[model samples]
Target chain A: MNLPKSVSIIEVGPRDGLQNEANFITTEIKKEFIQHLVCAEIKEMEVTSFVSPKWIPQMQDAAELIQSCYSSIRSIVLVPNKKGAERLLATNCKSAAVFVGVSNRFNQKNINKSTRESIVEIRPIIADLKSKGFFVRACISTAFYCHYEGAIATADTLALCQEFADAGVDELSVADTIGMATPAESFSLFSTLKQQLPNIMIAAHFHDTRKMALANIYAALQAGIDRFDTSAGGLGGCPFVPGATGNVATEDVVYMLERMNIKTGVKLDKLVKAIDIIAPHLSRKIDSGYYQLTKKRDISV
Target chain B: MNLPKSVSIIEVGPRDGLQNEANFITTEIKKEFIQHLVCAEIKEMEVTSFVSPKWIPQMQDAAELIQSCYSSIRSIVLVPNKKGAERLLATNCKSAAVFVGVSNRFNQKNINKSTRESIVEIRPIIADLKSKGFFVRACISTAFYCHYEGAIATADTLALCQEFADAGVDELSVADTIGMATPAESFSLFSTLKQQLPNIMIAAHFHDTRKMALANIYAALQAGIDRFDTSAGGLGGCPFVPGATGNVATEDVVYMLERMNIKTGVKLDKLVKAIDIIAPHLSRKIDSGYYQLTKKRDISV
Candidate 1:
């Protein structure tokens, strides 16, 4: 029952949420979505990814999206490799996010590189970003389980995160890539990470594919994690991870945290409104519990 | 992280799930649904209610359905008052469930009785049923929050449960009728109930109106609770609560518990099959997370 007094939510709907979307959303709408999130008091977010348009055509306008976003917000863009990092250096964004899967097979499928190779390539990039006073967050995908490889060994995930921590990253966002982690697994891994890497900020990113996202978040909170990566309207899934659903919805996370007396400094009503901006653009229905409840009933948060 | 090694699940989909449905399912389908749950190793279930046929036509065949169920399973029938209790006695059913809401306004709207009136009337009914060797479960509705009265006082809920415990009910089923209870509220209320009434068997019932059911369930588990009231396919919502959704799905709960290494003695794949029996008959789509994942992907549990 011991929980933090306040938690920080890092919005990921614009990037992680929309990357898997097949339909193209215009840069204007994406900017408008980020503006709505800014009004809702989201201080940090993963706005877009600097990747090849041929691979993920959805993020073709990453540079444009990052340049147009409000400079007051700590907009973080995903950089997959040295090329992506170089692409990010040209943009106005001061924050950059890099990722590597814990599973080699998943890494091979996602970026066509082995885990060791991605780590070796990304280490110097992290140091370079830090040397330039850039905030670098390492997103450790499949930290708990992988779609290609079954349950990930906790030691493997911990070792991978240790490498990133040693590389001078500001934070580590460990993810349940396929959303198959149980609360026990979440608590076990995050508690170890928090113990070993006490100086580094660790955020828990979860996909709601199995509907255990909130429970996993709660476990993470018990392990003293305060930062979360959430999607608006529960949008986004990994195109590489089959049957994966959206990240835990921002509105849903805010609702739970506020109800628990944990401060996220986000307005629930305004947060719910942000979902309306992007819900229609997506091919799937908004599956967020709080959003759907607000639509069906006249209840105020 | 201290949790029970195993948990028991009481299936409420047949009665609590279907009572609110406007469409009537045939008695044969209801029997087959119960049979499927039995095959999934559900040892106990709330099969049906003995309310007036005019009010809930869905349960008009309560007696008929219970009579046809497997005798080895513990079948519980809902009895609202003395009349419902008398009707339950007419059948061969040995278990009866009675309910009272914590909010007086919610009680009046749901059953046309004040909270005090309902408690006063049901006390002797519990005694009478106990004297007759009938196992009784007293369902405490709005244990955390009420739709009409807003957030309910934990003291009010505890006092009402105290009355039932004094009257010798076999177990107490504490419910979050509106699904508005947070994990903190759930942990605070249930932990007190567990500490105060240490000798009694207590079960947690949650509605997924806000999608915090699983998190609330996890909080309850941390508070030392091991029995839960779940619905197959996430079926059932209070017809009286305006925006209330279904209970936490049995399959999802089993998936979490089994993954956490907590035994529920329920086979998830077989439990999902039970949903197929009644899902087509319901007016709304099944909203369970695990159920949706199973249908979308070929991944085996």
Candidate 2:
């Protein structure tokens, strides 16, 4: 019952959401989607990633998309390496995100490197970003469970997060990458992180593969963490992770938070509208609960 | 973190799940479905309802279905009135469930009576059933939010549950009939109920309309609730409530419970098979998290 008074929603639909989409959405429509999210009052968002277009053709327009985003919002672009970080620096984006999976197998499969090697490579990148007065967000992927490695050790995840904290990253976005985390694990992990590293901002990112994303977010809230990374219309899944599905839907998160009397500074009606921009372009149906319910009412009316 | 070590799942797919299906499943199929649930080790089940065939023709074979179920499992039948109770009395079923809505408007629309009137009619029936040594479960519907009346008063729901407890019902199945209750509301209401009616067995029934059922269940668990009403493959919704969807899936519930180290005494893999018997006849797809994930894995393999 002792939940936070308010929480921040870090929208990731344009980046994490659309990255795995098989059908390529035009740059214009992606911009329109980001605009709708802005009008919904999303203060922070991962607009796109600066990774190689060969890896994720869906994100080929990353630079063009990030350049078109509203400067008023904190637009974050994922940086996979020094080259990706350089690409981010070329753009007007002030916030950059880096990722390292806790599991060695997942890390190797994702970026052809071990967990230790990835951390070693990214440590200087984060420090350099901080020195350049840029906001750095370390995306700790597979923090709770990995698709290849199974249930991750809490100690290993905490150690990886501590490495990012020491690297002067402004925030840490810990993810339940395969969506296999229970609320108990979410509470236990986040509680320790919050207690151990009290000053750094921490955001809980969850996938909806098992439909426990909202429940996980609720547990994180109870653990005294207020920031969340959500995708619009519950779009996006990890292409590298087999059976992985969408991120927790943005509209659903806002609805749950506002109902609990916790302010998110995001408009539900407008947020739902944002999903409409990209829903038709995708191969999958908009399966987010709130979005489907809204469409049902639309059809019934 | 102070969760119960074990929980009981009351399978309601037979009655609550199939009652709304437009297609009439054969009596033999219904019996097979119940048999599969028994294989899953479901100790309690709401087998069928004894309502008029004109209202719910799918349950027209209620008596025949109940007679075919295993006597080892606790098979419950829904008895709406004196006539239904009389029908139940004719069978070997030992448990009977009766229901009343907390909202007067919802009550009037559902059964053409006010909440108080429905309660008055059911009070004597409950007493009679208790005298006959039949186990009685009072389903308090619209306990949190009503589709017709918007948000329901916590005080009104508590008072209705208290009336049922005093009527000597063995258990109370409190429900968010419209699938609109928040986790905070679930925790607060159940906390108060557990405090006030400490001796009466209370179970939480949630619909996955907004995909918040699991979160609400987690919250209810935090409030010390160890019993839940779930449907196989996430079947069932209130026929009278517009836009209401499936009950929380039993497999998904068992997955979450078992993952959190809380026992439900039900085999999830076998429980999933129970859905196969009824899935083909359902109007909607089996959209429960765990069920869909299993199907996805099946397709991939």
Candidate 3:
């Protein structure tokens, strides 16, 4: 209960968010989203992903998003391979995020490679990125549970955590790909990862599918992992999964951390205003607890 | 992180819920809710409050809510005074819950009496209920922060907690009256309460207004408090404040606990189904996060 007073928040709405949406956002809207993310003053924003357009056509505008971004922000781009890393490296982006899936079936189902093959493929990509002197953060998906292969063990995800650490990735964030973790699972996994790789900074990425995302973040905090990935207005859902919900709402996470006397270096009212800007463009309700609270707060105030 | 394998959930939706709603629910529907709660196999349910109908017209049916029960259920009724306690004692209710706000200002605002006067009132009420052979649980409201007077130090709520324990009450449920508590504040209060009165069971009542209710519950659990007060579909908005949300959602609590491998003695699916019965009666959207998750779940499955 007695810990350092404040923690940092890593905002990932622009990148992790747009990648999961089915509709391809216009280059202008994607650019605006990034601008709004910057306006929120969230220091570590993951701007875009350089994955195959064929796989996730929604993010085909990655280059334009990066090209259009303002220079005052510190952003990280998700790059799938050396080609994507090479593409990202061409830009002024100083950091790139690499991904690996814990479940073999999920890796094959999602990214068109076996788990082992993906790790092998990622090593060179990470090495090349590191060699380029770009800050690297590795992401491991399905760390909690797999859609194709149910409940994953803590040891499985910890092994990949070791692999990422071995890859010399500066930071690692575990993604609850299918939103299947309990608070206990989240705490146990993060504690194990921290124990094994203390030098590697850890971030949490959670889907709000079962409404356990924020709770999972809370659990991770207990395990001493403070950084997190959240989407503005809860923008994206996995189209492949019929009923998956959006990512953890950035506003909600900030609201929680701020009230807990934890600092995330973001202004809440401005974040709500930014979410309001993005709400009209989305087809669904803003999947955020904060959006609702803020909306109510606005009317009441 | 590695503690008890499971935490128990106590649902207080019907009593805490119906008492706060603006609409008048008939005795028949109240009976249906009781039947539903029993069908859900919820181990503990706060069915109604034994307060003066003149002051709280919404809770006029406290005696009927327990008397007209169509199901075999162990019910607890909130008692505000000896008269109300005498009335509820006539019924088969197992426990009588007495309440007093910890803050002098909140106690005055909520019960129209100072802390000492409220305790003086609850003493006779608790003694009478105990004499009648009814189990008793005491609730201390505004234990964290008050809307009128923010910054309630842990010492004040702790002093109230000890008073409840000394009163020979069976359990104590602390409430964040205006949804103003952070996890740190909740942790500090609950840990101190457990340290002082380990035998007096502790439960939590939280509002999701600030989006910390679930995490606040998590913090309380880490502080070794298990039981909680929750409203199905997050039904109650504070009547005094009008449109202000109150009481954590029962469904969200079940979702968090079940995922954590906690045994709350409540059926998640049945609790989900109970939402339907309550949602239509609601004039506004239910604030429960699990409501959206469950709706998606039913459609997907």
Candidate 4:
């Protein structure tokens, strides 16, 4: 396929992939992962999160991981509320991502709060993040569907996006947490989200559990939204969300977009090389059809 | 990902996957691969091609490969034209598929015939198949892009598709040969194809070279198209087409669609069980991220 001249790769393996690994993966190794990402010519990375270990053990060392990493690339962190935002205040990371679920059931399951309650709670945190002159993004989860509650309504999702925008978030991330979306849903939602909130720059977060992550990205692109969150090797799919498999593999996404003449700004050979550096670290083989297929035989053997 | 109630697994490994492999897998091994696909619970299979042995040594043994098979599943062979279709007339295979390329350059490169010439050649062949009461399908290739020519116009694709529909082919299959399509393009194409040809069923054949296969499938589904073509273990991509990697994995597609609560009529546990029979003989590791990530520990080790 003829791809666009360039596209962006927002690396999320450090925060999304590592967050669910069974092994602790010391903060240093986490640093190595980030280091290799940079060596691969990556310009943006979601390094870690500021959250209590009680909720997720994988992210317990987020603060430490970020502290150890030294790079010019933009580093984004996940912050749940004002307390989490306050904790990131001391870190030098340039961006903070605040999340709220659009589906009521997902909000309750993800953060132990109602959709409205989570929106109200995350708003001030967003304001606080903006006040600090940091790039603040509101990640709207289950904006597509919720496993517990089934399909999410457009009205409910729109209200949450408006709240995030009104809260002064610099950017908005619409996510299909369960990978339950089709291109039609993504296109309509992204298009409507843009029409209503004309000022917000939108990024897309899709789960590949249903194998539609890349397609969702394509739909979002058609709706004129750019910026995407993808895991290296298609590495990250949330463990907390049952049936969810992985995010769109970074290399695969870059490959598809590039061939279609859409610019993803990702270096193909360099990204594949980065996957090589990561191959030995994990106990299991990484599953990216794109990598397994295109990888030169010498490396595969 | 939430899947539909079930999804159908169309095993294309033996025909599609092995076609590009440089290694000479003998007739005996080809039989074993077919058996393994059945073990994987694949309900429908495209097992072999009736093309000349001189051109494709990999598929030289159409008779032995088909005769040695031990399963009860329906099998179809791919025929480029009346000559290939004539070779398969004596077999009990019941069905065969002919291809039409949207790009003349690809058609000439692939079958040594121009796009219109290929269609003309296949029409009479399709008529003969009809007379014999054999089920036949016409696959339109390069519906999205071509290595030699980029971003094919929709009108050209539609004209080719209309030609096949007018010929009374039972189904229409659109392929993104080089992984060059996005969901918007897929949706738009599928919508237009379906609207123009209401009686004929539409199937999607995608390559994952640029990581947009699943996304394209999602778009087709949104456009209300079903009956997709996928490979066992995500085998086979068009090698001649640079940057193309593999077809969307059958297991991954099943997992995603089944979890979505759509009706695909495939069983996942049965599918995984089916793979055990041929996993060892596979020349390369399976190119599927979900299978690699969620592999049963015993097999992975």
Candidate 5:
């Protein structure tokens, strides 16, 4: 029953959410989506990623999205390397995120490097961002279970977190990349991380592939970790990791937290509206329970 | 995490799951669905409900289903009143479930009686069944919240449980009829129910309306309640309760329990196959997350 009075939700629909879509969403529509989120009082968001357009065609308008929109709130963009970091630095955004998979096989497949090599590559990027007075978040992907490598050792994930902490990252996010994490794994992993690294801030990122995302988020909350990465309309999935679904829905998370008397500072009705704005643009159907429930209400009423 | 080594799953698909379907599924298909669940090692199931065909045309073949399909497992049937119980007596099924909404407003709308009046009607039914050596389970519907009544008082729900327990009901099922219960609410409610009625068995039943069903189940497990009422392929919703969706998916529950190293005595693969068997016969999409993932895997593999 012990939980934080308030939680910080980092909305990632524009970046992680749209990047996996089979269809292309126009830049104007992306900005409109971000505007909807901002209207709903989502202060922190990953607007877009600065990865190469050839790598992910869905995110081809990353630069255009940052330049045209993302002025009112704290916008965090994903930067894969120094090149992506350079592009992010050119934008008006001050916060940047970097990801490194804990499993070697996953890292090799995802980022084309071993865990050690990826860590080595991101160390200077973190230092450079810190020197520039920018907030850097290091995400440890596949922290619990990896589709390619199977179960990952906690020691390996923690060591990666240690590396990020040493490199002076402002915060760390543990991701259930393939959405295979159970509540027990979520609690134990996040608890161990919190206990080991008391100084570093921790965020939880989960996929709903196995329908344990919200449960994992609840478990993470019980472990004293508060910040979470969520997607509006449950819009994201891992293209590289087979069977990975969208992040836990933002409206669903907001609803649960608010009902429990926990503060999320986000309006549920407005969040649903935001989801409705972009729901038709996506190729896949929205997988959010709250979103679906809201639609049902609209029809019945 | 102090979870039970083996959890009991009472499958309610044949009754609760199919009752809300818009399409008419034949009794043959219903029996095949029950057989698939039995093949998946499900030992306890609610085969069908003995309600009026006029009330729920989908469950009109309840007697024929119980007579033909349920042989190897423990079968439970839903009986709304003494009349329904009379029909249940004609069948070979020895277990019957009766429900009353915890909220008076919900009970009045759902069953055409006040909460207390509904309890009064079921007391004689319980006495009649117990005298015949039947296992009677009393379900408190809308235990946490109600669509018409909004948030229900915990004291009111516990009082209803006391009434049922005093009436010699064998077990109690706390249902979130609208799926509005949060993790904290689920844990606190079930924990209080367990503490107040330590001798009586308690089972958690939830709808996934707000997508908190599994999270609520995880919370209930933390509160030391091991038995759950789950519907296969996440079927079943309260037709009277607007915006209420399916029950917590059985395959999803089994996946979480097995991954947490808790035994459910149910095979995940076999359960998915059971869902696959019935997936084509349904009018709506299969709402189970594990079932969706299995479909994706099927397409890819």
Candidate 6:
């Protein structure tokens, strides 16, 4: 199984992670978290989301959080709609992420829009962002399976991916938002996407719900995908999906990649320290296996 | 990637998992745990070890546990040396597991014998067991990396495996006692072993110390390994090796395989219920991801 010499990890803790957290992280702590992550050499990160504060009150300070997190690394923000896009425009950040669910039921439940409607609705926003020189990362939520709709058709997911690519999106992210994918499904889906869209950059975002996230990441790597969306301390889960776990822990992924001789451009011990900074602020225990292992270092090799 | 249509799981939780617990589980509870696992259609299991009670107080009732767990399923017992082997010989159990670390330092520390000496000592024991109609599972601990000696040479591991095969052992088990093997290494090791010993059944026993156990299993499956040693509720760890996590949770592995449409003759829900039976009895928190996921059933897919 051939793999890339180096892999790029896009940390999504601030937005995807903290959003699922019950306790609102103070703006100062969020900024410190980002600063520590940048110290660990994370070049790309989703600093926060631009969704309406009324819906996700925790992200109420999205603009302020972004303003506070001044870093050399690329700062990407989640934009759920044209309003979110407009809010992102006022910020200094030049990168934004938009989403359209492959499962129509999920789209309806998550964004109150159909999958196609989400695509149609986000098209102008994506174009608007691009016109202003913003890099757009179009994410397909429930790319593998949806809690509401069960298994998603590969052809349908590919069609959504193709729509995003045609919209001139800078990147495409296939997300297992519900964390229901197996390694076989991950390998087949990502491999087919890579083969079909050789020119388009594809990224994988997996959840640890079923504990297959890292395994899925490994399979995707074998299928030639080197970019991933991860969260520090293994934070984040969907508020909509039941029993959904957090994203593949950044620490665990980095450990696996570094051990395999695949460069991740991140320091393991430093990353764990970064996790330590935000762990106490969170409402729940950190779920990253690597983080857990580090805490019990007394028993380790 | 090609995978087997079905796989066989050898449950090691009762022996490997319990052996590491600080609290001693009663023989009656162990018997009940074994019965529950058998209800889940688990055909193979390590019921307990026959080591001296003085060294491993937890397994003091190994003979009584095995005698109580009388069933059609293949109940294997761990035998450390000739004395343990003689004790197993007196029991109704017809299968026994013997192990030697490929890393000499680990062998010395774990078994108080060097690798070569341990092999020499077990040669006659294996022959005697075979003559007495006992099936022997020769395990090579630290097949990937050793906690005491660091990296174990692949050649040394393979040489030990070759010796066991020549001794007419019924099966060969390559173990990642410290969970240090990567997918590439797991694939390479198992693929090479399968090629060389086409007629011998090869089983993999992995600890989840680094959280790569399931990923390693996935890679090994691709390499044509059909039999695995798993623990129900992910129970297991090396008492001799510090920082080693439990085996890859049997429920998690079964979930992955069944999702991929590979049959394991085990029911996921039933297995979880079985784990619930032993959860309160465990001294520490259950280490299986699947077991933990089951606790928060409110967020499931």
- Model 6, A15-112: lDDT tens per residue? 88899777788988888888889989999999899998877989998988888445598899999998998888888899999988999999998889
| Residue A69 alpha-carbon offset, candidate 6, angstroms | 5.5
Across residues A173-211, which tens digit of lDDT does each residue of candidate 2 receive? 999999999999999999999999999999999998777
Per-residue lDDT of A1-301 in model 3, one digit per residue for the tens? 6544667777777777767666667888777666776777878888888988998897888887788546676688888876898798778888888887898888887778898998998898888888988789988888888777777877788888898889889999888877767777888888888788888788888887666676688888888887888888776766544566678888888887877778888987777777766667666777465677556632331
What local lDDT score does residue A170 receive in model 5, on the 0 to 100 scale? 87
Expressed as tens digits, the lDDT of each residue in B228-288 for candidate 4 is 8888677787755655667888877776566555766665565655554455666677756
lDDT of 6 by residue, B49-109 (tens): 9998888899998878887545689888999999999998888889988999999999998
TM-scores, chain A, per candidate: 0.98, 0.97, 0.94, 0.91, 0.97, 0.97
Error of 6 at B284 (Å): 1.9
Give the Å error, residue A130, model 1: 1.5
State how far residue B43 of model 5 sits from its true place (Å). 1.3
Which candidate tops DockQ? 1
lDDT of every model, 2 decimals: 0.90, 0.90, 0.77, 0.75, 0.87, 0.87
Of 3 and 4, the candidate ranking higher by TM-score: 3
Worst 10 residues of 5 chain B by lDDT: B292-301
| Residue B45 lDDT (model 6) | 88
Question: Tens-digit lDDT track for model 2 on B1-301?
Answer: 8989999999999999999999999999899899999999999999999999998999999888887556898899999889999998888888999999999999998888899999999999999999999999999999998887788999999999999999999999999998888889899999999999999999999998887888999999999999999999988998898788889999888999999999999998888888888788778899887888777752221
DockQ of each: 0.71, 0.55, 0.40, 0.28, 0.62, 0.65
Error of 4 at A162 (Å): 2.8
Prediction 6 TM-score vs. true: 0.97
Residue B268 error, candidate 6, Å = 1.9
Clashing pairs in 5: none
Q: Which stretches of candidate 2 lie over 4 Å from their true place?
A: A298-301, B298-301
